[model samples]
Target: MRHAYTVETVRAAERTLMSRLPPGTLMQRAAAGLAAACGSLMHGTYSRRVVVLAGSGDNGGDALYAAARLARRGAGVTAVLLTPDKAHPGGLAALRRAGGRTLPPEPEAADQAIAQAHLILDGIVGIGGRGGLRPQAAHLARTARESRATVVAVDLPSGIDPDTGETPGETVHADATVTFGSYKPGLLIDPAAEHVGALRLIDIGLGPYLPPPELEALQHADVAALLPTPVGETDKYRRGVVGVVAGSERYPGAAVLAVGGALRGGAGAVRYVGPGAEAVIARYPETLVTSGPPSKAGRVQAWVVGPGLGDDRAARQAVAEVLGSDVPVLVDADALRLADRDQIRRRTAATVLTPHAGEAAALLSADRADVESARLAHVKQLAEAYQATVLLKGSTTLIAQRGHPVRVNPTGTAWLSTAGSGDVLSGLTGSLLAAGLTARDAASVGAYLHGLAGRETPVPFGAHELADRIPQVWRSVHPRT
Candidate 1:
């Protein structure tokens, strides 16, 4: 699992590590890593043009010292100091000694350096910076975007909220970010994540000093450990059956896609109940279908409710019956709208709610734009409000449950944004829940597998193709010995 710590946690860890080391030791380590990365970006050190946007903190020192290293190696480096008077004294002196020149934040000199430089290192602000960039820094960011140089941010891109992944104002768009010590939440979550083109973590021995992560993302090995494996004694019932209540006459395709997803999710059998019975049977003849309510849909280890289920009387009845069952339930799509909030909060069994930004916004009574901008905060709030595991899907798929580290899915692609994708996800997650995974585990694992499948599928594909590819991704994660 890849872990992301908050700014406070990172600061605490840095303080602890800094205390044990001699003065300037950590900065030297950081400078070495940053300089090595900058050197690798260039074809050769000789006569290479590099520009550094240095601020007034340790982050500025990191950039300035790195520029000095490059200058000593025959690169012509220049520093554009946003805070000329407050710039790191040691870093400024080092750069001058190594033949690097300093330029004030004058538009002319700064513009000239940015336009002609091969690379630009952003160190205008550190993790403690909140809101947006200052006027000078914002201008540099805009100029850097308009320039031909490859922009590399130090620690993090300037103007991003390190703790919440929120970019309240103008932020630098980097070709890549070289973060020190550990991953920050803003680097992994989006709008800020979108600005961070590529991410590279540099270790400065802060791991042992850091506390538990605020968020985590699972990799192949972690998913492999969590996936359920069938034993010799495991029969169809023992392996688990997932009950799906989805689709309407208006959108029978929702039922078919959801059932397809459940079938691929390691479930021994899938029992589907809804108005789309005939359509589902036509596509997946193996599905056990019923026109009755979910309560009469035979025994199931878990229930998935609300994909294309309209707000009709029967839909409400079906949702109520399923919620009444003493089994885990996954709520999605139109069902998120039709189901009673009180009942959802009152459920005895585990519940997982999957919502895209708009659906999440409706639930929270907030603007969708706000939810999208502050995804980390909204997902956490939704999880706590409903007392259920919540999966907020978008550029970054996040799974949050109260009292646990929020999970960010790193495998998602924007191509997975097609129609009925959420339905397929609901079915797959419900099947995992049936297989005895906790709501949190089920949602995270389902998202991980679904995203991998989406990536594996050819572009411009439909939701059905996405569902078909799940087992392939699953096997890749948990291969036979």
Candidate 2:
């Protein structure tokens, strides 16, 4: 799993690392890492021109000192100081002593330096800065951006809010980011994450003092462990069965997609019970399709309700019946729109709600932008409000259960925006739940597999293609005999 620590945790870790090391030792270590990365970018480093966009904080110190190292190695280095008076004094002197020149803040000067340079280091702001870049910094950053030189951010992009993954105004776009200590939430989460190209971590030996991570993304191995496995003595009944109530005359494709995902999932058997039984049978003959309500769908260890079921009276009845079931329930698509938050909160069995940003906004009575701005907070609120596991879908998918650290899915490709994809996700997650995975595990593992499938598919794929790719994803994660 890839874990992301909060800024408070990062600062605490830095403090601990500083306490154990000699003065200036940590800074030197950071600078050394930065210089090494810059060397790799320039291949041999000799005769190469490098520009450092210096700021006021230790982040600028890192860039300035790194420039000094490069200058000593025969690279022509220049520090374009944004805040000369407040810049790191020790770093400034060191750069000059190593033959690196400092340039005054001028648009023409900055633009020329960037254009002539092979590489540009963005040090305008680090994790400390919030909102966006100041006007001067913005202009210099834009100039660097327009240049042909490769731009490398010191810690993070200059204008990105490191804590919230937000960009208010002007931001520097980097080809790569060399971050210290650990991965920041902003580098991994979306909006701000989109601006950060490739991410590399430099261990300053601060891992000991860092607190538990606020969010985690499960890797292939983690997903493999969470996935259900059958024993030699286990029967079909022991493995678990899933009941699916989805689709209607108007949206028969949803039933096919949902059942396809469920069959490819870990469930022993999928019992399809809804209006679109004929479509489900036509597509997946293996699925036990029945033209009955969810309550009379024989027996199932878990239930997946509301994929394409419209706002008809029968669809609402099916949702109410599934909610009354003692088995774990996964509510998605149209069902998510029709769910009673109060009834969901009172349920004894585990209930997981999968909603896109728009559905989440309606459920929380907030705007979609509000939910997107405060994704972590909003997802947690939904979990608390409905007393159910909530999965908020977006670029950075968030899964939250009460009293557990939120799990953010980071593996999806943009191709997942295709139609009926959510139905497939619901079916897969419901199957995992039926197979005895906890709500949190089911949601996280389901997302991981679904995302891997999306990435494995060829571009411009539809939902059926995504569903068909699930078995291959499972095999990639867990090779079968």
Candidate 3:
């Protein structure tokens, strides 16, 4: 798992680590790491032009010290000090000693240096920065961006909320970012993630002091450990059975797509109940199909309801029966509209609710924009409101369940915005739940796999194609003998 720490936790760890070391030791370690990264970005350090956007505080100190190192290595380094008087005195003295020149914060000189530079280091604002950049810094940042210089941000890009990844105003766009101590939430999530072209985390010995991660993105190894493996004693029924209640005559493809996802979700068998039984049988003859309600769909380990299920009388009744059953349930799409809030809240078995921003907004009676803007907050709220695991799908897919750490999916591309994708996701998650994973684990793993499939699938591909790629990714994560 790739863990992200909040600013507070990072600061605390830095302080604890710094307390035990000599006064300037930690900063020197950080500067050395920064300078090394800068060197690698260049063809050679000798006679190369490097510009450092040195602003207030230790972030500027880091930039200035790293610039001094570059100057000593024969790079023509210039420091554009945003706060000349308040700049770190040690850093300034070292730069001057190493023959580095300083330029006052003037747009003309700044732009010229930025335009001619081989590299630009952004230290105008650090992780503590909030809102947008000041005029002088923003202008220099804009110039650097317009130039061909390879821009590297110190810590994080200027003008992003380090904690929440919210870009309220103008932010620096960097070719790469070198963060110190630990990863900040902003560098890992969008719309700020878009600003961070490439990310490199430089450990300054702050790991032991840091607390538990505020956010975590699972990697392949973590997903591998969580995936279910069949034992010698396992039979088809023992492996698990997933019951899918989806589709209508108007949109029979939803049933086909959902069943496709379930088949690859490690389920021993899939029992499908819906109006699209004929279409499902035609496509997946292996599926046990019935034109009956979910309750009468034989024994199933878990139930997936609501994909392409219109808000008609039969759809409403199907949702009610699924909720009333003692088995785990995953509700999605049109079922989100017809399902009773109280019925969902009162369910005893595990429940996973997957909603896009619009559906989440409807559930909370808030604007879609609001839900999209504050996804982390809204996803948790929905999980609590319905007393179910909630998966809010978007640029950053989040899975939240009450009393559990909200998981952000790092996989996936914008291409996943195609239609019927959510249906596949719902079925995949339900199958995992049937495989005996908790609601939270099922939702998160399903999202991770689904997003990986989206990334593997060709662009402009349909939802069915996305489903077809799931098994490839699953095998890649953990291959069966």
RMSD of each: 1.3, 1.5, 1.6
Best by TM-score: 1
lDDT of 2 at 348: 97
Sorted on TM-score, highest at the top, how do the candidates line up? Answer: 1, 2, 3
lDDT of 3 at 380: 83
TM-score of predicted model 3? 0.96
Give the Cα error of residue 390 in candidate 2, in Å: 1.4
Q: Tens digit of lDDT per residue, candidate 2, span 227-328?
A: 788889988778889999999999989998888888877889999988888888888888987888776678999999999999999999899999988999
Q: What C-alpha lDDT do the candidate models reach, one value each?
A: 0.92, 0.89, 0.89
Q: Clashing pairs in model 1?
A: none
User: CA shift at 213, candidate 3, in angstroms?
Assistant: 1.6
Give lDDT tens digits, candidate 1, residues 200-263: 8888999999888999999999999999899989988888999999999999999999999999
On lDDT, who's better, 1 or 3?
1
Q: Residue 409 error for model 2, in Å?
A: 1.3
Model 2 worst lDDT window (10 residues): 472-481
